[model samples]
Target: METLCNNFPSKLTFGHDAKRTLLVGAFALGTYQGVKLTGNFLAGVWKHLLRPGYDLKKRYASDSSECWAVVTGAAMGIGKEYAKQLGRRGFNILAIDKDESEMEKTQAELSRLGIKVKTIIWDFGKISNAESYEAFEKELKNATNGLDIGILVNNAAEFQQESLDMISVDRLFRASSVNSLTPALLARYFIPKMLARYNNGLKSAIINVGTNAAEIQNPRYKFAVYGASKAYLHILSSGMREVWGDKIDIMTAIPRQTKTPMCPVDYCFTATPRAHVNAILSQLGHESETYGTMTHDIEYYMRFGMFGGFVIDNMIQWLNEGESKKLISAYERRMS
Candidate 1:
């Protein structure tokens, strides 16, 4: 009985020690995560709020008229907004798109900004056709001749919201061409020129517009091709930054849903094209990769970080399913 009493007190003491150890471990982990999250939050605040964007005018020569800002997919939506904003900022604009009439309209709008506006009507979807690409190259060279191009915005992309089986081979090829090949080739063609200008003491920048869908860790249901292609662009931009970031400012702008013809939804979180472009422009040289707007950043963390993978995955599936229903309904109505 005496030995049993002594052993019971020892067991109780050991249990107490184990509980204490667990509590300490949990506290330490919580504190570490808290610190990490706090640091990230403050860094974001600094990048988005405190830091001012680089003076883009300084990128030009003494004669700003010689400098040009090249923007692809510039006929409408975010690309058009980028062209307008860049033109307003004193840079002559070279708007490239497949739609001639839309390009003409964009040119008219930009011309009112009093900056020189030029258009190149070349379809990026024809990237697989060697002869077509060569023709586009010639046209681009001719258009940019005698002009000091300072900025390149690779904003052209083909969005396909279909499952793998539903996606047509032609569309797959076109998406690969437009979403991946065009940006890669454009950067390859322009980087040397940009480097030459940079060597001559001119600043240069490249903004490769990507999508938030690329960053999601979960399976992107109908966005297999689109997401992967944009992911390629994002990584390409990162690689370019590694190689040429010192001389030229290279950034990837990843925006969420914005109110555009491509994505016509006007949810509370959806950004306007002008506002989205403004947010992206404000972060140039400040961030290598950005969500483009504060709302998107918040949404990203909430969906991916706080809500976890299961929630986000289901949410995405639901949204994509809803979009699929709308598309099917529209097609049926057209047929009827």
Candidate 2:
């Protein structure tokens, strides 16, 4: 057997037929993988983009008479849009935010839709601390009184791009409070009510607004406690879905560039607040996790699907670093 192996011909001595056959097999394997990837990509496109998505009215059985929707960070950006859309969908709104004036405006706008609008002015950024937590809980309890909450949108967040030494311990803690702790507390407070409502034949949903960066480990976003906090929320939502079973709908929407005050206004693949929130609402019960926009869905498959996390992380890091530099310049101009 050893002698036969040693006597095997080298590639140079192979017959034309053998070489052609080997080449054909290699091409066939490559073609198979290419076809598989293409099929997966197309299927994802059909599900996320082309699909009509979940029908909110049908999900709630067309009865939103006494249902209330709670939206954190409801003053501006995607959060504000969530409040408005839900209000339009016939759900009364409880808008929670740090900005009293902005929330007042939101309340007025939502009120015009003939839906009750309750504004709760409190700083979620301080929610992790005992003193602030107690105060927030008190406010939440009062705000939720006599209300049957059918949906909870955890859209509040804090974001900073500072290196370890540059970011204060206080800042880190606040980011954690806003992005992670507040969502957990809010869900804990409202989920039981949602479940009770569900048992009464009312459907409920929880949407944890997440970030694409949370799914990828990019060192450039190392200073982003925002991503880390969102990652915690992402995993928490996944577990909550399992724990709640069919009692309530749970989703974690990981969006890419959304044109918000916190993010660059003209970034590539950026979606308007209305567009972003629409995508999120459409995909709510249909998917436990989604990119939240067609552009984000395409970007996700192209980046994560084709190159995996490492290259995707580097791409994100490159974008983040550029945005950070722009932020620094803008800050310097403001200071000067």
- lDDT winner among the candidates? 1
Once model 2 is optimally superposed onto the true structure by TM-score, how far is the C-alpha of residue 171 displaced, in angstroms?
0.4
Q: What is the TM-score of each candidate against the true structure?
A: 0.88, 0.85
For model 2, which pairs clash? none
**Model 1 residue 216 lDDT?**
54
lDDT of 2: 0.79
* Model 1 weakest lDDT span, ten residues long: 327-336
Model 1 TM-score (2 dp) = 0.88
Candidate 2 lDDT score at position 188: 89
lDDT of 2 by residue, 1-336 (tens): 989988886555678999999999999988987997899888777776688866675675425457788899999888999988988777778889998888888778777878788889988876766787888888889888878788899999877666667877987888788889999999988888888788788888999998876875324244456677788999999999999958899988776778776665354567888988888898788888887777777766666565355676466657666666776555446446
lDDT of 1 by residue, 72-122 (tens): 999999999999888878788999999999899989988877978988998
For candidate 2, the per-residue lDDT at 208 reads: 91
Reference-based lDDT, each prediction: 0.82, 0.79
